[model samples]
Target chain A: MADEAHGEGGGLSFHPMDQFEVKPLFGGYDVHWYTITNVTLWLALAILAIIGLMVLTTSKRATVPGRGQSIAELMYGFVYKMVEDVTGKDGIKYFPYIMTLFMFILCANFLGLIPMSFTTTSHIAVTAILGFGVFIAVTVLGFVKNGASFLGLFWVSSAPLPLRPVLAIIEIISYFVRPVSHSIRLAGNMMAGHAVLKVFAGFAQVAAIAPVAIIGVMAIYGLEVLVSAIQAYVFTILTCVYLKDALHPHH
Target chain B: MADNTNAAAEVAAGTQAGMPQLNVGTFDNQIFWLLVTLVVIYFVLSRVALPRIAAILAERQGTITNDIAAAEDLKAKAEAAEAAYDKALADARAEAQRIAGETKAAIQADLDVAIEKADAEIAAKAAESEKAIADIRAGAQDAVKEVAKDAAKDIVALMGGKADAKSITAAVTARMKG
Candidate 1:
C-alpha cells in the first residue's frame, strides 16, 4: 500500500504551471488558455450576475422604492459611502473602479469557497497581474494629473537637500516594489491558507483518529473562509490607497 | 492478471524515476498570471464602469437641487399668504374699533339732546301754571267788590223814606245785631 501511495504521489507531482495547458484552436490560428481563461470566464459571469440584479431591481424606479430596489439602492449607497469616506468628492470619479474591485474580489473569493470550484486567486501569477496593472494605471494617472511635479513625490523637498537623494532613492525603490509586495501579499495568503487546508484534508483522509481529523478539517475550513474575505478587503484597500497617491502625489 | 501486475510495476517504476526530480520553481509563472488578472480588473474599472457611476451621481445631485428650489418657492408663497392674512386681520380690527367709537359718540350726543329738551319743557309748564293762578285770583277779587256794592244798596232801600241819618244808622245796627 505504501509503495502504491508513493507511486501515485510521484505520478501526480508536476510543475504548478503544468495544471494550466494551452491548446491550439481554430486550426492553430488561435490558442485557448486554461487558468487565465477560467478566471476571465468567472469574472465575466460575476459581472453579468451583478448587472442582471441591478437591472431587475431598477426597472421600476419607484418613488417609494420596493424591496428589490431598496436592496440595490442600499448596495449602491454603501459603495458610494465607502468611496466618499476614503477618497472624498474627488474620489467620486473612481467610484466604479473601487466598487468593481470590491465586488469582483468578493465574488471570486466566495466562489472559490464553493465545493469543487477553481480559485483563480490561489495562483500567485493571477495576483501579480492584478497588482501590476493597478501599479501601471496609478503611475500613469499621477503623471497625467500632476505632470512633472509627480517626480517630486520621491524627493519630498521637506527633507534637507543632502538627505533628499537618499530618501528619493529609497522612495523610488519602494514605489517600484509596490506591485511585487501587493501581489505577493494576496497570493501568498491565499496559497498558504489553501495549501494548509489541502494538507489537513489529506491528513483527514489518511489519519487513523477520526475525531482529531474532523476537528482539524473543520477548524481550517472556518479559518479559510475568514482569510479569504480578509485578503479581498486588503487587496481592495491597497488599491484605493494607491489611487489616492496617484491623485494627490504629494502625501 | 500477470500482465496487469507488470504494467502496474512499470508505472510504479516510472513514478519512482520522477520523484527525485521535483522542481519547485513556479513562482515566476504565478506572478506573471497575477499581473495579468490585475491589469484586466483595472482596465474594466477605469474604462467602462466609472463613467456610468459619475453620470448617475451628477443626475441625482441635479434632482436634489431642483427639489430644494421647489420647496423654497413654496415656502416663500406660504410666507406671503401669512403676511396678507395678518394684514387683513389688523385692518379688520382697526375698522371695528372705528365703528365702535362712532356709534358710542352718536349715542352720547343723542342722550345729551334728549336731556336738554326735557329740562326746557318742565320749566315752561311751571311758568304757565303760575299765570293761570294769578288770573283766577283777580277775577275773584272783582266779584267780591260787586257783591259788596249790591248789599249796600239793598240795606239803604230797606230803611224808611225820610228817616234821618241817625235813625237809619240805629236801624242798620239793630239788623246787624239780629
Candidate 2:
C-alpha cells in the first residue's frame, strides 16, 4: 500500500496509515490467532528489552549503579513512586504488576520510534486489552474489596439530594468511559505521531519541499519521542488512578 | 483464518484497507500476542526484574542510612577529641602558672631571710665600733688630766714658791670642778 502511494503518483502521495499494517513475519497472509506476525516479533523484542534493562543490567545489583543499571533503577523508582503516589501506600502491593505495564509500554513506545519499526502500542486492540484489563481488574477489585459499595464510586454523596441521581448518572457514564479514554489516548497518540511522521516522510519525496519535509520529520520525530514517553506515563498513571478508585471508592 | 476473510479481501484490494488498526483480521493476532506479551512481561517483572530492582533500591537506602550514621559518629568523636585537647591545654597552662608562682615565693622567702641576717650583723659591728671609740676617748681624757697636774706643779716651782702636794691636788680639783 505504501508502494502504491508512492508509485501511483509522480505527484505527492501520502499513505501514512500503511505503516500500521500487521504482516506475518514468515510471509503468510493468513493472520490466525496464533500467527507469528510482526506484533509477535515486536512484542518479543519488547520482552527482551525488558529483560535486558531490568534483569541483565541489575544482575550485579550494585548499590552504586552503573549506566544500564542506573536506567533500570531509575525506571523502577519512577514507576514505583507513581504507583505509590497515585494509588497510595496500599498500592505498593501491586508495584510489580504496575512495573510490568510501565516497562512494557515504555520499551514498546521507544522501540516504535526506530525507523520502520512496528509500533505495537499504536493498535487499539493492543491498548484496549491493557486499558480494559485495568478496568476489569479495578472493577473486580473494587467489588471484591468494597462489595456493593463499589457502586458508591458513581454516587456523589456530597451533592444535593435532588441532584444526587443526576450526578450518579453522569458519574456512571464517566466511569464507563474511563477504559475507552484510557486506551484510545495512548493508541491515538502513538498512531497520530507515527502517521504524521509517515506523512512528512512522504512529503520528502517531493524535491522542492524535501528539505522542509525532512526538517518537519525531524521536528515531529522529536515530538513523537516526547509523546511516546508521555503516553506511556499517562497510561500507567491512569492505571494507578483507576486502581486508586478501586481501592478506595468512597471519594 | 476464515474470520479474517473480509480483511484479507480488503488487503487484497490493496488500497482501501483504511486504518490498519481497524482491520478486524489482525485484531486476534494483535490481542493474542499482546496478551502473551503482557503475560511474559508480567512474569519477568514480578519474578525477576522488579524484585531485583527493589532489593537494589532498599540496599542502597540501607547503605546511605548507615553511612550517614557513621559520619555523624565520626563527627562526634572528632568534637570530643578537640574538647579533650582543649581541656589538657588549659590544665597544662594552670600547672605552669602554679609552678612559676611557687618558685617566685620560695626565692622571695630566701631573700627576706638573707636581708634580715645582714641587718643584724651590721648592727653588731656598729655597736663594737662605738665601744672602741668610747674607750679611746676615756684614755685620752685621763692622759690630759695627768698633764695638767704636772704642768701646774712645774709652774709653782718656777715661781720660787713650793706648793704642797695635797694643796695642789685640792687646787686642781677645784679648778676642774669650776
Candidate 3:
C-alpha cells in the first residue's frame, strides 16, 4: 500500500488510490476464493466489535446497565423504534434481520475509519449482497402476502386513466432499480469518503505541506464519521420503507 | 484473480501503478469473510446479545413496577393507620365526655339525696325541741302554784287566822291559769 506513495523525483509524490489495494496477508501474487487477506482481517474485526459490545459487555445483564451495556441497549431500542415507526407494528417480526443488517454495516463503516484499516462496506461485493438481499426478500414477501394484487404497487390506480400506463412504466423502472441504487449508494459513499481521505493523507508526504494536509485529513475524518453513521441509518430506514410497502401495498 | 494480483505485485515491486481495490481479484476472499462475519454476528445478536439486552430492559421495567406497587401499598397502609388512629381518638373523646357527664349526674343525684335526708333530720329535731318546751312550760306553772299555796298558809298562821287549804289551792291555781 505504501509503495505507490512515492514517485519519480525521489521527492514525495502521492498515489491517493493505493490505500484500497487488496493483497494477500501471507505475501502472495494469487488471490483464491480462500485467500486470507486484509479484507478478511478487518471484516473479522467488525464482527468481534459487535460481539464484544453486544455479548461480552452485556454478559452480566444488569437492570442498571454499565456503559457498554447501555450502548448496546440504546442501539437495540433505536433500531427497534425505527422499524416500528416506519413499518408499523406488523413489520416487527422482521426486526432481527433488519437489526443484523444495521449492526453489521454500522460496525463495518466505523471500523473502516480506523487508520490503515481496510473498509469492507466500501467494496461493491459486500454491499451488493446486503442490498440485493433486501430487494429480493421484499419483492418475494410482497408477492406472497398480497398475491397477484401485488402488481397494484406499480399500477398507480390513483393517477388519471390516460396517464396510468405511463405512470406504471415509471414505477416499474424505479422498482427494479431499487437494488442497484441501494448497493451503489452505500458503496459509493464509503468509497468516495475513504478515497478523499487517502488523497489528503498522500498530500502530507510533502514536507512543506504536511501540516496543512494533516489538518485537512482531521476535518474530513470528522465528517466521514458522521457520514458513516448516517449511511447506516439510511440503509436501515430504506429497508423499513420497502417492508412497509410489502405489508401495505395499497399505501 | 491471478492476473489482478500479479499486476498489484508487479506495481508494488516494480513500477508502482494500480488500484488493487478495483482488481476484482480478491472479491472471493472479501465476500467469503463477509458472509462468515455477518452470519456469526447475526446469530450472536439475535440469539445471545439481543435477548440478554431485552431481558435486562424487561427486568428494569418489572423492578420499577414492583417498586411503584410497593409504594402504593405502603401509602394505603399508612392512610388506613391514620384513619384508625383518628377513629380511636374520636371514640376515646366521646367516652371521656360520656363518663364526665355520667359522673356529674351521679354526684348531683347523691347530693340531692343527702340534702333530703338533712332536711328531714332538721325537721324532726325541731318538732322534738318544741314538744320539750311545751312540757317544760306546764311543769313550771304547777310548781309556781304549789309555792304560792304554801306562802298563803304561812301568812294565815302568822296572823292567827286560819284559811282552808283547798280554797287557797283553788285560788292560786285559778290566778296562775288566768
Candidate 4:
C-alpha cells in the first residue's frame, strides 16, 4: 500500500509513525483490552527470547560453561553485580526481579531493531507500567521497612535548618517525577530513533539521494543498536538506584 | 503529492492524526499484554533459571576449594617424602663413615700386633747370638791356659829341673789374669 501510494505520483510517501500504530493481529482494528494485538505478539516473542537465553541455554547448568551457557552466566553476573553494586547486600534478594526486567527490555529492544518488527518498549503504556511498577514497589518496600520514617528520604537533615523545608519540597516533587522521567526516557529514545530510521528510509524513495540516505540509515542503525543495549542498562540501573534509596534513605 | 496526501489521510485515520503513542485507544491492550509478559518472565526467572545458575556457581566454588586443599595435601606429602629421602641419605653416609672408621681401627690393631711380634723375635735372636759368642770365648780361654801350662812343663823338663805341679798351675793362672 505504501509503494502504491508512492507509485501514484512518483513522490516519496512513508509513514514514520505508522510502525508504532497498534493493530489487532486477528483482522479487526478495534483494540479491546483482550484483543490479541501486535503488542501481544511482540511481548510473547520477548518472553520466548528470554526463555531461550535464560532457561534453555542454561538447562545443562555446566560448571565449565559452553558458549551459550557462558553468555547466560555473563548476563547473570553482569546484572547481579549491577544490583549488588547499586543496592548493596540487602538488594541481592531482589536480584531475580531486576534481572527479569533487564532481560525483557534488552530482548525486546534488540528484537525491535529487526526490519518491520514491532518495538514493544517504544510504547509509553508499556514502559510506564515498568517504571511505575518499580516506583510503587520501592515506595511500598520503604514504608514497610521503615514506616513513617520513609519520609526522611525527602527531609535533607544534612542541609542547614532554614533550607530543609525547601529541599524537602523539591525532593518530594522529584520523587514523584521519577516514574515519569524513567518511562519517558526509554520510550522517547526508542520512538525517536525508530522514527528517524523510517524517515531516512522514506528518503530512499527519491532517486537522487537514495545512496546517501541508505548510508545514513546504516550509520543510524549502528547507533540504534548501541542505544538499544544502553537504554536497557540505564533502565535497569535506575531501578537499582531507586531500590537503594528505599533500602537506605538517609543520604 | 496526491498519493502522499492519501497516505497521510490513511495514517490519520489509523493513528488519530498525531503520535501513535498518544493514541488512547491502544493503551489498555498494551498495558495488559505488558503486565502478562512481566508476570510470565518474573515467574520463569525466579523459579528456574536464577536458582540453577546460583547452584552452578556455588558448586564451582566448592570444587575449586577442594582442589586447592587436595593440592596442599599433595605438596605436604611430597615434602615429607623429600625429608625422608634426605634423612635416609644422611644415615647411610653416617653408617659408611662408621664402617670406614671400624675397618681402619681393625687394620691398625693388626699392624701394631704384627710390628710388636717382629721386634720381639729380633731381640731374642740377638740374645742367642751373644750367649753363643760368650761360651766360645770362655772355651777359648780354658784351652789357652791349658796350652800355656803344657809349654811351661816342657820348658822346665827340657832344662832338667824338677817341676812342681801346684806352682805351675798357680803361675799359669797369674799369667792369664795379667
lDDT of 4 by residue, A176-201 (tens): 99999999999999999999999899
Q: For residues A1-251, what per-residue lDDT tens digits would candidate 1 score against the true structure?
A: 23343346643321222222221222221222333344455545555555554445655555556786666666567677776766668878877766766766666676666654556676655666678878998899999999999888897788888999999999999999999999888767766665565555555555476568678878977988998878877887788778878887785
Candidate 3 vs. true structure, TM-score: 0.76
For model 1, residues B1-178, the per-residue Cα lDDT tens digits are 5335534643442322221112123334334444455456556545644444444556667888999999999999999999999999999999999999999999989988987887788778777877787788777655654454455556666773444556645555565446
By TM-score rank, best first, the candidates go 2, 4, 3, 1
Interface RMSD values, listed in order for every candidate: 8.5, 3.8, 3.9, 3.5
Q: Which regions of candidate 3 deviate over 4 angstroms?
A: A1-10, B1-19, B96-178
User: DockQ values for all predictions?
Assistant: 0.06, 0.37, 0.32, 0.33
lDDT of each: 0.63, 0.88, 0.85, 0.91
Best by TM-score: 2
Residue A11 deviation, candidate 3, in Å?
3.1
True contacts kept of each: 0.12, 0.80, 0.74, 0.75
The residue-by-residue lDDT of candidate 3 on A38-102, one tens digit each, is 88888888888999878988898888889988899999999999999999999998998899999
Ranking by lDDT: 4, 2, 3, 1
**Per-residue lDDT over A25-133 for candidate 2, one digit per residue giving the tens place of the 0 to 100 score:** 8975778889898899999999999999889999998888999999988898898889988999999999888888888899999999999899999999999999999
Using DockQ as the measure, name the better of candidate 1 and candidate 2: 2
**Chain B TM-scores across candidates:** 0.43, 0.54, 0.49, 0.55
Task: Summarize candidate 2's per-residue lDDT along B1-178 as a digit string, tens digits.
Answer: 4325644655663424568888887888899988888899999999988878888889999999999999999999999999999999999999999999999999999988988888888889888988988898788766766777788899999998898878887788778768
lDDT of 4 at B12: 50
